[model samples]
Target: MHPEVAQLIERSHRLGADPTITNYAGGNASCKGAEPDPVTGSDVELLWVKGSGGDLGTLTEAGLAVLRLDRMRALVDVYPGVEREDEMVAAFDFCLHGKGGAAPSIDTAMHGLVDAPHVDHLHPDAGIAFAAAADGEALTKECFGDRVAWVPWRRPGFQLGLDIARIHAEHPEAIGVVLGGHGITAWGATSQECEEHALEIIRACQAYIERNGRPDPFGPVVAGYEPMPPEERRARAAALAPLIRGLASTDRPQVGHYTDSDAVLDFVAREHHPRLAALGTSCPDHFLRTKVRPLVLDLPATAPLAEVEERLRALHAAYRDDYRAYYERYADDATPAMRGADPAIVLVPGVGMFSFGKDKQTARVAGEFYVNAINVMRGAEAISTYRPIEEREKFRIEYWALEEAKLARMPKPKPLATRVAFVTGAGSGIGRAIAERLAAEGACVVVADLNTEAAAEVAKGIGGTDVAVPVSVDVTDEEQVQAALDEAALAFGGVDLVVNNAGLSISRPLLETTTADWDVQHRVMARGSFLVSRAAAAAMIAQGLGGDIIYISSKNGVFAGPNNVAYGAAKADQAHQVRLLAAELGEHGIRVNGINPDGVVRGSGIFASGWGAQRAAVYGVPEEKLGEYYAQRTLLKKEVLPEHVAAAVVALTAGDLAQTTGLHIPVDSGVAAAFLR
Candidate 1:
């Protein structure tokens, strides 16, 4: 590859990866270079354009489609309007110099027409403020002073490419071009020069914005709204997430919640928030992620669950109807088929913004974009009324065939994608393994533990901050248990699976057992289990989505060992409780089950807290050999690992055991004495 082309690929990725400048699907770049034609063995000018659906941040050689520059330029006359989008794309594909298998960016013609060796384009929020301004051309002059060319907005296609080519021809000395109500473009002899030129234009726009923007008057009003504490707020978000999720889709969608950002609060608190937020996004590119406008929902901060649920249903109906009307108004022969009309974003007055997608990552991406979009809206509103590209333009981009192809290109979702799992005592041991495993299987996880730092670390390790969220929880406290369930709900819409794995053990001869030891054991194992199970069930019921509740039981629950009265009794209570809960909650589709493992001493919380040494002493074996001794005692002579326990939890929640509920899955290496009939 030519050094200049390599430089172009690197520079393009840098601009594409930055959400402040461009999102995952927006922006394009290209470099003109000479390459050996496969058939002729002669150097020919070729355009290395960013491929369709390729993210600039992660662009590689494969992402750069190699197209003959001569062929691209020849299309200037043959370029048809948006109605022939398919044909134009086919022509670009046909011009490929080799079997690269990547489709050239739809903007290849525009890039080819530019005389420079390198070209870069981006949809930076700062630049959008200038491009989408009513006086965008004047702003372009004010910012660049004729150093940059100006081209009015045209629906992006053959005509748009021709017009851009004409602009470049007219302004032969210009460093960049501002496409009014669209995006910005820059060109130079080298890739670095093009990148530098793009940044300079963006900085100029930023300066213009800083000079003309106004101060936010309601800054204190939003700041003073006094949100509920994190736990309560999380609970609220979780409680309300299912209601909103139910309204958003008919396929029993797995909904999650995201409402803890400063930008969200600021936007949601404005007195004119409904009108301002509903106006439109900053650019047409965002239409694919955020829809043309967010669904503005008015729910009081102090509203009860029933009230909130009712409001969500009403608002959902109105929002969908409005979306249908918008589509009906804009649908025409030139547009692609109308896609799903669901609103991806929800704006709550005095609360914050919530973004929904098919899975956790998608939802997070939407939220990140909305956060950036809010700042863009802020920048534009400060200077003048923020005007996005018109609705018709957004409609075209939203339903564009190229954009649909991008969606289709994404990999198929995992089986548990979009599912949310809440696990207790997830800081370490079997709980931690289960959390990690669930996240890997595509379920968003809430890591709840008494160890705050450990829980945080576990969450960070699972899938970064977005996929796994950590919350400090004490299962013995009713309020904390309920709050933790809420946190799980809010973190990922609503919890579809709950793992009750938090427990402790007490072992002593019946005569020596003390009140303190017995109380502690029962408090943690029995009362803790009850509290967590009850709270999680309520949240799941409210979600109106049938889910799973898995209790980590003990083999001792049925086959009690000597000197294990307190621990064994509590474990037994959990087994019976699981059956009762399953029988009662079956009507609501909540399946309750248990996993009984006899001697998973190593790496377990019980073992970590000195239970292994104590139990080894009782068995007349050295602590180092305790694990082997316990394995030898089982029928299969196999070690019961934390991962084995975790597998049972996964099996119960993953729809693999969909028909089998209220049953115990033993992970004790086939302990015949402890096995359930």
Candidate 2:
């Protein structure tokens, strides 16, 4: 390859963010100067470059344009509209007739304006795919190793040159440039070198596309772009800013507002990915920017702006207000989060984007979201298109305490945990209770307690399968655990959630503790937790699905609980083992947390006599009164039940706990809280 061509390829390959306009004609590459190459001082001084509209894949020299570089650059700078464009056309007209009728690229003036020794451009599919991604810059880096400078999406021309100017200022070593949402620009020291670099970059893009691309599955859905009058456009855009901002959100129960793109009208007006907005946000970050989905506005719908806005406003307020109520209900932050900015997403029917933000970060994020949403809306025309996990699931992921802490650097979730989960032992007890909660939120659940009787009963009780399922699993044995998981997978198509909630419990004064009793507790509590956890984890890992594994431990591990050494230690060991297990399996994306509830009594195996029984005796009350007596000692004055513990299990297993890999929720009502008291 020519040295200049080689440089071009290296730079383009280095920048994978450019979205080739396959829908438009491909890119144009050229080198123009007032004079020809100085090879042996030959006076061929002129532009020798790829001709107009040449596909980069199989381009040739015969396709190049030889023009006066300075003239080309100067024209590119002033071409405001048809008049200037006509002037540029005339310059090339002279070059074509006298020099040769080689049609220069549509961007010929653009190429000449840059004043580089060598220049190249191409519409690479890899760059387009990367550009289409939500995290365009980061994805660009991953696809292209190095050599290209990054640029975000912008209209072509002067702004693009300004970008080049910035690149020159920033990186003197830069050989090429990438325009986000556009295409790559490569240049080198010589014509042949620049051509080779352009080809190399195209090949890289082709390779990436071949490796990952699926068929478009549709004929071209490209649409025409007509400019809107600036005065009306700006007036509408400014007027609509607050409305759009209100649409963006980040709270589980949304609180932030964001902007929406008018381009979405073309997308959602169709019968495609627009459906996803009906379901939910495409990605977690979308919630912060677009409020799960856009509140579509269409030109076909004969509605007044005020009426439409007012009606949708209530609709928007309904969602935002509902989300706000939800946030207030579940969130524990010192400062309350806003549900959404306000207006929510709006589609100006056929206009481009009208999304808003507090600043560029927010606005750009909102715009990026509209791009994805619009694309999905387009893609939806092809396949099932877009579907979202439940809103409650989104809330969980958004509000996860640990996940909240990583806001500064975290990207978005990949929808790996978008399915439903059903935990055993939900109800008034831990197992039974988790079921009701996961159900109350959105998960289609199968609540399994030792109650097989309860399992079938709850299934029948919840009715029709839209909601809950009660199953019985003697978690200590491999057979029952497998059966429950199999049934759950069969019912849910897959289990994205798994919480092993069956364990043994028994209490004894230290002197009276027996080996057989210890063996029984370990067999059921420790062994049961292990057997269930192992099977569940294997299924999740093998499915290439990441999930959560939570152990039911007790306060006996660390706190001083007399005569509960075996039970406490085993529970502690369970916690320790899972912590290590979490570390080892972190790359797999599985999370494991333990729960040590100090006061729960569905069937207390280890804590039967120590806490509950002793509390009854100490308080001089009947066993029933022990619940009230213990409630007074905890931080909150509520009786800790199996139900309460179950809620904690659901949180750890749900989408909200993205980074929360190792933790034990102490569900002793206020027992753990009492220490604060």
Candidate 3:
């Protein structure tokens, strides 16, 4: 058998067991390694082909059947029928009968059309984005433009075989062929060449979508939601100019608008309200990349652009809330096949479509996906039917146990599974107990405090890390915090449990707070929180590892942190940052959250260290009384311990909370959940 075919079968068998490449076991390949394996003496010029029921990524030599190259070429002109195709397949399989129970790949006939020794084929999810389009052929040629050749979708049989032969005869130099609604066929003199061709075809299709047909940034315009007024938009645009330009990643930011008149709006929005969002994309690949819909709105002539912009913000917020609710609903009420990430939709009100991305490339990629989705929606609408995967089936595929297992097994610094955690400031102390408990649960504990020596002693006693490593890091210094996190990453390859345990608590009347104190609080509370989270996020994103970030935020952030101006405001900012990071990086698979533990202690590093104790003394409570006082204030009537908070943190980062992200899980007990308005 050809060595190339041998490798292809070997590769297929390996991946076949993986659920991610589930369902479709079909693929093809050719390689320069197409040499006969010397058995005894006679020359064996047989082709190694992937057999049916084989996964391309996990195959072995035994998984392929050998067919004489000359024989296959001879059959091309024979105008073989289904009977012949079956016989060919059975005969091919028979050749490798002693090798294993493996069968022959379905496209064995087409394999003869290629002269290259190396070849490969697979029905990649991304490749099909363009292949299954209503204008699949036209779009394929337009995007690839002569870089590759294409064949119309034909029923796979004798006629299809003849068509492929004709196309090959015409475009002899073409190294690859893509059949609409089918799969691609790539070949090369060497295995590398064939693989590269496959990669390039995918890249070209993805690149074309990223370039030619992207969606808008703002979102699909909504009813009563018009474009920002010229002056208002200009002003807001300027506000964003600095940040947007920094992240634009282009010579120029292609900022633009899409405001549909009543006619266009009515045309799309007439019968199908929500379904109209899908009309913007042209294919199914878009669904895989950008979800299946966008948002739509109606804009009023008199509404101020600023007001409309504000409403848009509300819309985004509402969408997120609905997303969470939908996930919870599907998960709790009944089985809705496990939905993957709640897909972002194109909002198409008065504003045509608002495309979003961290950079121009991402935005453009997302836009192309959106356009294809629109096409799918439009085509299906023509038939008065447009359906994505059946809900349960979609859920099953999205949340396939195999896929879920694969996602769980994603490469990471370390396998962070089934571990417990301990956080410091246990009890009325929010961050502490989190640290202490996570440690008790098997992790090397991390004790953080302004009392450097005290924390060191705690570390020695807690003994979580080979005995918790004692290190003093002020939350404010980016360098110090980042270095500490780096140390942790290096020490353990990665950190599975984290409790943003260090914080400050100052209850000064907002108006009377001094500027120095305010700035210090901001540096310690808000900026410090940002630095640590940023460092952790970078690490997690790099390895595609998802972990838990339990920000020891106070209930004050959610319930209007009063009296304490600097502390409350800083903590509030921390909470918001958690949400933003969650939304932006969810695709990368990282999750963020805030833990409102109410109160821990006055002498905690945040408030007691430096100004923390002084601030606490002014409130007339000795540092010792701080913990109990806060605990008594809770509705649970039970004290909130650092261990309790730590346990919660551990559960979240562990397998128990696999799909949970962007949550504000309140560990303040039942009391905090019903905090007084």
Candidate 4:
């Protein structure tokens, strides 16, 4: 890579990783460099800009699109007659340097218009304060004096690029330009120079705010209403997660949730929050991700859970109706086709705030933009009333063919894309395998284990924190179990699948088994299963969406062995618990099932805990051949693998057996001796 191009990538990552300045999906950067032309051996000038549909923080070399400089500049001269958005996009497509990978950013022309070697464009909350205000142009002049130029908000397109080029020509000495109700752009001869100038512009605005007395955002707006304390706010979030997730859909949709961050609380606690939230987002870029306006729900701390769910359903319907009306109100022959508006953020009065995403990372991006919006609006209100770009302009941007194409290009979702799963004892062995499989199938996983380090390792292996979250929990402890359940709700909306797979095997005969060993076995198996089931059931019920609960039992539960006393008894009780819970939860649409597997002890906690040699010696078999000994005894003569057990778990949870529950499925490679009629 050219040195200037490498520097652009590094600086873009820095800005993208910082939530205060930009989000996972927004922002763009570019550098003018020279590369060998594909057709000839000669070097040519190229505009390498960040491409569409990739996160800037983890962007790679392939993510940048290289375009012929002269071709891009020529579009300005012959673009007067082009009115259709698709034709404009085609003009950009035709300018790509031969066989270049990825589509160039929609702002490619805007970057080319600036007469600088390096250009940086970002949406920082501090800088957007000036642009999103009613008196933004005057404030922009006051803060930077003559160092920056001001451009009025225009929909990003060929015309906007031409206007920016004209402004650059008018103010030749300016180092940066602030686009009203959009964002900021900084241009310099070097990458470092551009980044520094961008930061300098933001800090100047922040210093200006510090010098003036900050105005109270909530003083006279809602005088009688008081906000909940931090602890109560968290409690309310936990209780409301299921209802929100259920009201979202009935396809067992995977949903993720986030509580009030500092910026979120600051906005929702204000008395004038309703009026502020009614306005559109500061930038058109965010409209595609978070919609024009959020869905505001007036939930109070005093509302009962049942009543809250009913009210939430009504509010959801109303929000959808309003969205359709708005789309129809502004749409006409000139506007591009639009998609249905889905609510991305939820605001609850006196309780807290919540944001939803298809999965964990997407949900986080939505929250980041909403939080930035709140802060920018607050700053604008401090100077003057915040006035975002009008709704009609946002509608045009939201329905633009280019924006709609991004969503259309996305690959087909995995089978469990919208599901959230909780697995206990997920530090290693069978539980670990099950959790990994769920994540690979696109479900967000919550890894719970008594070993904190092991749980953290599993989470790290999953790659993204939003996709896999780690929490420490001792299953036998009621409080710990309940807390784990709450953690899942707070992290990923609510729980749809619960795997009660946290138990150990103890090989002891009734004649020699000590009370201590027996007690430990029952506590881990019977008691733990009871506590986890109750907590998971409550969450699934509250969502009003039926879910699945799978218990990992043993073949020994049905066919007793000579030395097994406590292990066999506990497994039996656990299986029965599944049937009992299924009977009771059926009215709520929740399914409960169990998996019975035998002799798959290799790599299992049972063998790792020192049962391998002891059990082998009793059967007069070599310790290393214990697994083989058990396999030959099965009807199919095949050893059961951890993956085999994992596949059964997936089948039951995937709704293949949606109408079937209450019975344990065998996964011991055709073990007729342990099969159920």
Candidate 5:
């Protein structure tokens, strides 16, 4: 790789890693270097820029688009002006340097046309504050004088790139320019110089805003909008997340993210919040993720729960109606159809923010982008009135043909995408395998287990909070079960797939099974399944998106076995619960099923906890050979593994068996006694 190109990647990483410098996948960086032409065997200048849909912090060689600078610049002569600038994006492909490393982004022209060795385009809150201000040009001049210039608002495309090139040529002494109602762009003769110039402009703007900014820029907090106490605030957020997620997913299902950060709380509670949010986000990247704006609830956090839910429902309906109208008003013959009328973000006074998307990362990033908008609003209001670009311009960008094309290029979603699964006892054994499998199929999993450390480890291994969250829950305690479900709601909107796998085995004859042993076994297996299923059912019903409930019962539930009286009865209870709930929940589209596996001793938490020794003693076989004994009894002569059970779960939920419910799948490797009659 060229030294300059390597430096460009390093520079992009440094700038992208800081949230204050640029948002996720929001900025682009480029470097111009001479490389040998493959055909001519002569040196040719090439422009290497961050590719479309790539995040800078995690960028690699595959994420940079390589283009021949000469061909890129030659497009200027054929440019059909601003009205036809979008065609330029397609033209960029023709300028590729031996098949571009990555697809060139819309900003490719902006970087290629600029007359500098290195260029950085970023969306820093401080710079956007000036960009979003009503008198942005004057503020830019006030902040950095002639060192950083200002360019008027223009939609990003070939024309805007030309506009910036003109500004750069007109002001040779300027280090960068703040693009009106957008972001900032900087250039330098060297990579280090370019990075330094970008940071200098950003820090300078931040300092100016801080030094000259007024206190309470968002205005004093309103009486009803003051933040709730920490514990109460979190409780409220958890309570509302599912309902909000349901509403947001009206057009299409969305995973949710919750935040009660000081910035969001402060903004939502302030007097000027409604008006500024109504003005919508200023930057294209900001609004693209956040929607045009958020839907803010107009009530206090202390309002009765029922009343709050009622108001939210009404507000959501109005938001959808308004969004549809907005789309209709701006749409022309060539415009892409309105994607969805539902809001991506929702704000409640005193509670903070909830952002939704098709997945957790997207949802989290949407919330982060809204926080950036809040910062921009605060800074702009502190210096001057906040004035974002007009709604028409925002609509143009939001529904751009290029953006639609990009969306079309995205890989098809996984079968379990947008599904949230609550897997109890996911710390180890069959439950852990089930959790991991669900996540791999694209479901967000709540790894609930009594062993908090084990659950945390499993969650971390499955990609941390983005894909799974660990929750400590004693299934026997109804309160803990409820709290675990609440955590699921807060973490990923709500539960739509539930695996009731928490269990224990106490193998003994009826006479030897004391009352204490009987009660303990039933409490953990029968009552535990009941508690988890009941709570999860409520959430799924409320979400109005039908769900799946799988009970990991055992073959002993049906097959008669020696010294298994207590364990068998408890498993029997779970198997019945599956049938009863399946009959009841079908109207609501909730599928309830069961998996029965025999002598899963190898990774079985139940067997490891003394049950295996007792069972082995009863069968007169070595503990290690117990699995072989069980396998010998099976027609398939196979030992049932945890992964086999996990696969059964995937089979039930992954679309093919959508219409099949109230069924018991025996994963006992074809044990005759375990077969369903």
Candidate 6:
């Protein structure tokens, strides 16, 4: 790679990594450098810019769009003006250097047309504060004087690029310009100079705001609007998350993220929150992720839970209706159909914020973007009135043809993409495999286990907080089970899939199976499954999204194996719970099923905990050969592995067996006695 290209990537990373500099996937950087031409064997000037839909912090060579500078500049002559500027994006492909690196973004023209070696376009909260202010031009002049220019609001397109180019050419002494109601753009003769200039402007703007800003910018907190205590706040957030998620997913299912950060809490509890939130986010990137604005739940934080829920439901319905009307008012013959009328963000006085999207990362990012908007609002309102772009302009960007085309280009979602799974005993063995498999198929998993450390390790391996979260729970404790479900709701909206896999085995004859042993086994297996399923059922029902409940029952439940009285009875109880719940939950679209595996000794937590040796002694087979002995009795002569059981779970929930419920699928490698009759 050329030195400048490497430096550009490094520069992008430095700027993108800081939230104060830019948001995730929100900015673009470019460098103009010479590369050897394959055909001509001569150095040709190329513009390598951050590609569309790529995050700068994680950018690589593959994420940069390489375009021939000469061809890119030539498009200016054929530019059809602002009304037809979108056509210029298609023309970028023709300006590609070779096959191009990645798809060029809408801002490609901004970098390519600028008359500088390096250019950086970013959305720093401080800079956008000035841009989003009512008297933004005057504020820009007051803060930076002639060093940074100010341009009036204009949608990103060829015309805006041309506008910035003209500004750059007109003011040779200026380091950058704050685009009105948008973001900041800086350029330099060298990569280092460009990065320095961008930082300088951002830092200066931040300093200016801090030095001159007024106190209580969002206004003083209203009575009863102060944030609740930490524990109580989270508890409230947990209780409301599923209902909020259900409302947000009315048009399409969405994963959720919650934040009770000081910034969100302070903003939400303040007197000006309703007004500023209704004004909506100023930046296109912010509003696109956060919707036009948030749906703020009216009423003080001290309201009764029932009253709060009632208000939220009414508010959500009004939000949807208002969103639909907003779309209808601005839409034209060529506009893309309204994607969905549901709000992506929700705010409650004491409860902070909840943001939703098709996946956890997106949902989390949406909340982050809203926080950025809050920061921008603070700075703007501190110095001057916050004045975002008009709603029509926001609608234009939100429903842009290019954005719709980008959405169309996205790959189809995985089968379990929007679903959240709660897997008990996911620390090891079959439960761990099931958790990992569900995540691979795109479900967000809650790895619940009595072994906290083990559960955390498994969750980390599956992709950390974004894809999986760990919860320590003793399944026998109903309170712990309920808390785990609440954690699931707080972590990813609500539960859509529950795997009752936490179990133990105490193999012994009736005489040897003491009352203590019998009670312990039943308590962990039967009562545990009941507790988890009941709590999860409430969450799923609250979400109003149908869900799946799977039990990892064993062949011992039906096969009546010797020296297994206590264990077999518990398994039998679980198997029956599946049938009974399946019959009951079908109306709510909840499918309850069971997987009966004969003898899963390898990687079996139960076997490792002494059950294997006892069972081996009973069958007169070596402990190590127990799996083989069980397989020998099977028609397929195959040892049932944890992965096999995990696969059975995927089969039941991944849609092919959607209509199949109240079923018991045996994963005992074709054990005749274990077959469900």
Q: What root-mean-square deviation over C-alphas does model 5 reach?
A: 1.1
Error of 6 at 266 (Å): 0.3
- Candidate 2 lands at a TM-score of 0.37
lDDT per residue for candidate 3 within 454-528, as digits (tens), equals 666666666634425555677778777755654443223334455665666556776778898689878876887
* TM-score result, candidate 3: 0.37
Q: What are the candidates' C-alpha RMSDs?
A: 3.4, 24.4, 15.7, 2.5, 1.1, 0.9
Candidate 5 residues 1-677, lDDT tens each?
89998999999989999987899999999999999999999999999999999998989989999999999999999999888899999999999998789999999999999999999999999999999999999999988899999899999999989988988999999999999999999999999999999999999999998899998999998998899999889888888888889899999999999999999999989999989988999999999999998999989878998999999999999998999999999999999999999988899999989999999999999999999999999999999999999999999999999999999999999989999999999999999999999999999999999999999999999996989999999999999999999999989988899999999888888889899999999999999999999999999888888899999999989998998888999999999999999999999999999999888887888789998899999999999999999899899999988999999999999999999899999999888877788
lDDT of model 6 at residue 600?
90
Clashing pairs in 4: 253-418, 254-418, 254-419
Candidate 5, pairs of clashing residues: none
Model 2 residue 470 lDDT score: 68
Order the candidates by TM-score, highest first.
Answer: 6, 5, 4, 1, 2, 3
Residue-level lDDT of model 2, residues 1-677, one tens digit each, is 33444443344333323433221224665554443344455444355555554444444454555665444455544657632343445466554523553566445554655556766665444444444344556645655656666777554444455466567557766667666545577776676666566656656655654565445422333332222345444434433332333333222111122222344434534433334455555333345456655555433333344564566456666656665675676566543354343434455433445444332234444555556545433333233223344566556545643233434334453222234465755432565565556655555666777756766665566554645556677767788877776555434433546665655555666677789868877777677777777766665554444667777676655566555666776776676867787887778777888777776755443235355665465457787677777778777788777667766776676567778977776777656532311
Per-model tally of clashing residue pairs: 5, 78, 118, 3, 0, 0
State every prediction's TM-score relative to the real structure.
Answer: 0.89, 0.37, 0.37, 0.94, 0.98, 0.99
Clashing pairs in 6: none
Runs of candidate 2 with Cα error greater than 4 angstroms are 1-418, 601-615, 618-621, 636-638, 669-677
Number of colliding residue pairs in model 1:
5
lDDT of 6 by residue, 181-240 (tens): 999999999999999999999999999999999989999989999999988999998988
- Ten contiguous residues with the weakest lDDT in model 3: 241-250
Let me know the TM-score candidate 6 reaches against the reference structure.
0.99
